[model samples]
Target: MAEAFTIRYIQPLWFIWVIIAVYIVFYAVFNHTEINVGAYWFAVITIAYILISAFVNPRDEMYASIIGMPLGILWAMYERKIDSYFEIGFLRKEIVAIVAFVILFIGRLTLSVVGFDNQLFQSVLRNIITIAFIVPLIELLKKVKIQKRFLIWLGTISYEIYIIHPFILYFFEKETTEGKQVGNLEIVLWTIGLTLLLSSVLQIVQDNLVRKVKL
Candidate 1:
């Protein structure tokens, strides 16, 4: 379980950060003229790596997220651009971007689902599909007016939730293995609720500690 988790989650996170740092350095050293160009290059390199990895080592599925990191960064950059459009009430460019994103998303998903069983290829396609989905999803989110207080709190603590949820899962598994008679649905609900509460507390503690250290 530890090995599988490391391979599936930890290694991919490390790989993505390494690639992101490399791209950041490359942009700073060579072409600080425009960030969008850097994002484009990062996207291109990520895609190229995916394709190459597909041919070279089709079994390594973790490398697929190499593309996802850049695509996420690119989406962030694009979100900034769209903010500018929103300010000026000029949505034509955003609309075009959304349409392109939809097309690429569909293509990527189709390839991922219906294409060959090659791990590398499927993983690359999945990364592309996720990347393609981010743009339009963000665009749609921009139009949404979310006003719920609980939702706002959830959003604030989301990063903590993400980090702590795995521990919750682990604890759930341990409990079940020890013959705890919790139902599956009960375990899931308890995990989620406990994760939320614990993560929020953790975040508060972290914030306070940071403040104290800064002082």
Candidate 2:
């Protein structure tokens, strides 16, 4: 498996040119608000230069492109060692859950007392937190797993995870939102549990679809 991944490091120069051209086209199209004819032409010229450099210095190009990622990860580890126990000290999952419950309960009481009605603010904050913390943590956790097969399978089914989540949200969203708002423990648990359960099942279906296409 390692050897298979290593082989991709020597992809043909033509593919690099193809990548550069496609990038120029897509970037120009996406940035039409700022990209004028001169800017587009300059971008094309710059992309050509990058491709030329890649072809002329294949090893350097390959290392510059891929090597920095792992090095950056190692540098992060060097700065802050992973002390999971210390980080999560005295707080088991259940304790953490209880803490979250207490915080939400207090927040609800405070909001009622203050007569605050900022549903939009709450929704925006939830989205910001999910994108900033949850999504990145999920991706980092995925990388830490030592199982190659697990990662491969996850990669295969990630599209389904992304696509099916909206449908699941649409179906259970009202009940889930109401439960959370009312601080209903049972509904909160059931919503999370069902979402995960259904998402996993959908992943399997997506994997089958991917296999059919690849085969």
Candidate 3:
């Protein structure tokens, strides 16, 4: 049982936990500072992920959870390794997503406790947590047949939705800041509405594009 758990839950990239720990240390120190070193480090890491992904063959590292989830399926299909698809089950998919969300939420709450304005913290926390969890959860959920379809959509045209969401929030924040008092319910409703509308619009656009391109 122990060996099975180890083989299933543990992947080759366990060292990433150490990397993330270091990042969290820097993030804690720099989150509200003028130096913005955390953001710079984030940019560097993003660049590295993009570069590393390009060089690695899609087969060997396919089952790595988080960003590797969807890539694994693609690699499996590419390499005809469908029989070994059980390798991905090692990850308790929702557990990791939940943990990531909790970490981000606590991080933001810590920032608030340290003297950042409540309004600012509330304004940014939801969106930031969503993004932080997206990639972390995607790899696990993507391995499931049903969620694979949804996540592939997210993976494909994600940039458009990501960029557009901030502007959408900016407009909403402007309205609230101008005169409209944003109650808790109002904020909740706005988030639900914005997420649904934007997600639907992006899905439709992606579907149309896929059909046009014969993908």
Winning candidate number (TM-score): 1
Considering TM-score, where higher is better, how would the candidates rank from best to worst? 1, 3, 2
Q: Name the runs in model 3 displaced over 4 angstroms.
A: 1-164
Tens digit of per-residue lDDT, candidate 2, span 1-215: 32354734324333333333444443444344332453445445544654465567533432223222223223333434433332545235335545565565566557756977454334333333333343234434544755788676666656445544444444455555556453456545665566556667877764554343311
Q: Largest lDDT belongs to which candidate? A: 1
User: CA shift at 151, candidate 2, in angstroms?
Assistant: 4.3
How high is the lDDT of residue 26 in model 1?
45
Clashing pairs for predicted structure model 3, backbone only: 69-139
Across 56-149, the per-residue lDDT of candidate 3 in tens digits comes to 6343222122233223224433443432442465456456567888998898878878887444234435555765565455555546666577
> Cα deviation in Å at residue 26, candidate 3?
35
Worst 10 residues of 3 by lDDT: 60-69
Q: State candidate 2's TM-score.
A: 0.27
Show model 2 residue runs off by greater than 4 Å: 1-115, 135-143, 155-159, 165-215
